[model samples]
Target: MRVRGRLTWGRRARAGAALLACVVAPAVVLSPGVAVAGAAAAGAAVAGTPVCQVRDDRLREISGMVATDDGYVVINDGADDEALRRIFFLNQRCAVVRSVAYPSRPRDTEDLAIGRDGTVWVADIGDNDHSRPTIAIWRLAPGAAKPVLHRMTYPDGAHDAEALLLDADGRPLVITKGGSGTVFLYAPTTALRPGATTPMASVGQVTLPRTSTSNPFLFLGRGVVTGAASAPDGRRVVLRSYADAFEYDVPAGDVVTALTSGTARITPLPDEPQGESITYSRDGRSLLTVSESADQPPGTRPTILRYPVAAAADAAAHPTGSAGPVSAGPGAPTSVRPAAEEASGAGARPWALVAGAGTLLALLGLAGVLRSRHTARR
Candidate 1:
């Protein structure tokens, strides 16, 4: 009587990918010719090329991604009790260097950014239902014993956010995934004390060009902003979506001006499996993109793509302006946990507990899934 033995990683990612498919899939099935034509058109639109593919199963649900001198660090989007909240470190070859578990559970981290001082900031500010009065941001200086959690509340109201950026001084700045298409700004007004709730200052706004969201397929190229990454010097940044990525050259560290009045260099992305994460390479010469893999049977895993920035940087059509007000917690002293002591390999799997009724569901659900898998293998 197996309970949850058959609930594999690929199956879990497929569930996420299925959601994207449903949103973009057409109601009427396409004819064979139309399908081929659609694929061709899609191919033409994806100009960003992939440098390599990451094969790790743990990162199949990766959401927040940022590149560091050592490698790219990422985290899963799961916020539930049964879900994991760990940081996965990937090297240049897209191989796992390490996976660091959090000291405690994070509510709903959606994006990540690296500050000027080499500190990693994790955006725990996700309010899908706008039910939370306050959201949190986690700060980590790699090899730290624990994260410094900085909690903040929106001054206006609860607004869902997935993008976060730290200024040259390590201050946190958030952009709301608002309906107005005007990227709403939320800057911290005071030093982010670990336990104190700080007020999010609305100092400025960056109104992006409004795009239609009627057709699901087309919407991929024109949906709400999902992720953001700023250049190391705070001189540039990029905003990402499901199917497209826009680059802004922040002139004089001004992000608001770029978002509002500056022209952006748009780079269309290939159809990614629930793609949501984007970042800049350590050298600031290329853009790296990641997707949440729905690695179904005989399908693809999450891909790590590097879009050439040499041309894009030289061809900056319009420069972005900047200004700001924000706060960041004082750096908390940290001690690294020993590699042997930290979870690794199989031990790194999330902390999940199931009992009673959950056990029953696992048995039935696992049986059906196992049966289908066996049939597929045959």
Candidate 2:
């Protein structure tokens, strides 16, 4: 089965009108044993302490993440409802402040890229089933209402895209999510008209080892391939998967340079690795990864892990020479707000809770009093 469809022009304006319209297989049915094993090996390698757990039963897969002006926005290829596509907002310290869901059909959300002006772009480019004709991007503001989806068709029908990245100038670059991966450069001239998407210019391909899969039709097996990002200069790109990561230098002439390799020096994560997403902070000081456990029960929550750019880059540039394996804990720390402002930001929430409790208490007291009065009258 393949997803084939025609693209429409003026997609941006029509997005709002298409806002309202919107399942997955049984949990065990989709599980791949080999994929799980690969995740275990990778997890055992990255042995950092556990970070906080962002619990959500509907979160099936997290494709991408980007740091917005307000905080961090994490995107998930949610389960059940197509409308379940969610973008979670976190504060500077990684506290989730809010979330915005997009009104879209059930398509795979691969990754995200934040524009220079704070435009949140959610890329629905992950088509593992090969049933979608076209992919899309749901755009929204940092604190805006529901997102508006702008659908775009690839030049030659659908291809599984795992990475979504925008350069400093707001041009989109799509990374192929395949065993034999290729990087497609979408020039800024690539317009958003219906049926008008420019065919991706295949600039580079990765020579990597391939793994086995139960379904030959599926391009990417249980192994989730992701983490495509563009540096501030728009000349450098960073990419990674469950096992390996890489950095490339894009010269002004569009020439690409490889700066790091899969075995490069980097902090290791827990052994049960799944759900790999990456994004660079605006300040360029940090590269954050939100990972989910492959062995967790179907509805297990996700984890957001952060790696300092300097340390990670140092390791990525110097892998084998550096410590072969670092240690990471099983889970993350609890979500705790900053002390000084926690009282203020969290104060309003408690009042609503207090009001709810007070209302409940008052209702109970009234009911008891009425009962007593009825008995006396009787």
Candidate 3:
């Protein structure tokens, strides 16, 4: 069902209340500390100013975003509809300037990166079920009409990833999303062939430091890397989770070394609902962020938030080191399967079931409200 224009008040309320119940109910049932911590974190962080609100309904599930001189470039998450699966370029006021269609429907495009030379790379590395034989990346060079596809396979096995980083040399690096704070890194072992699959070797791993940052997802959200970006100057890089953003200094343009053995400055992005998109501003002095509006009220549009680079640097005097190298062997485990993966199987959790039921009720309530309004008008 395609949603067009602004939603009515009843629809908005129904969506908001249902989603709130689904999230809040689980938090209360599980632990009160989670909610309390989230609240405290929200109060501690400096609030980001809203630059602009997304008006396009098709951009509801924005997963990856990158800042451009004109405005920004964004991509939606895995959508069943092929029409919604394209790269969108938004102007400074958050208006869709133009969009470039992918050569084919992407499996699950999760992250986006652009090189210094105006080469855009779209990472289609999301393997939630760990079943995809070969994940892929799409490259759109400067002035190219369409993106060229480059398929890649993991040397070990299939792993789910959402963060993609492009080094100063414009080489793409994929970071796995492991629930346990520790995540593995992978880089292309050989030159990428447009139509042929290339093997990705396990390079190293880094464990994100535990923080007191609060988010809707609570503790589980702290470890997952949702999005990534590099500084335009090539001096720094960042990886963000649902709750916070971690920035590392890239010494001499070696992004891999920075991720494997660097100290990270942590900035809390508190209480973001499914925050998944991040990028550095054109000047590299601030970080811009956007969240998916799925859990927000109906008709709610996602807004871009800007945080100063100094805020992150000043969060801690002596930031703890969170990077470390791991064995780059084929036997190395790339990721610890998240709870959602387990829930996808026979052992589904009770909280997940409750959330599903709440969603159904929300849909039914919206239908009833719409139907009653039509009858009243007649």
lDDT of 1 by residue, 87-182 (tens): 777887779877766666776678999877667888887665566778888888856866788789988888778889776566788987553245
lDDT tens digits, residue span 161-190, model 3: 989998777778999977658899999988
Candidate 1: 10-residue stretch with minimal lDDT: 325-334
Provide the RMSD of all predictions against the true structure, rounded to 1 decimal. Answer: 15.9, 20.6, 10.7
List TM-score per model, in order.
0.69, 0.57, 0.75
Q: What ranking emerges by TM-score with the best candidate at the front?
A: 3, 1, 2
In angstroms, what RMSD does candidate 3 have relative to the true structure? 10.7
Error of 1 at 345 (Å): 59
Worst 10 residues of 3 by lDDT: 326-335
Question: lDDT order of candidates, best first?
Answer: 3, 1, 2
Error of 3 at 8 (Å): 22
Q: List the pairs of residues colliding in candidate 3.
A: none
> Which of the predicted structures, 1 or 2, would earn the higher TM-score when compared with the native?
1
The better candidate by TM-score, 2 or 3, is 3
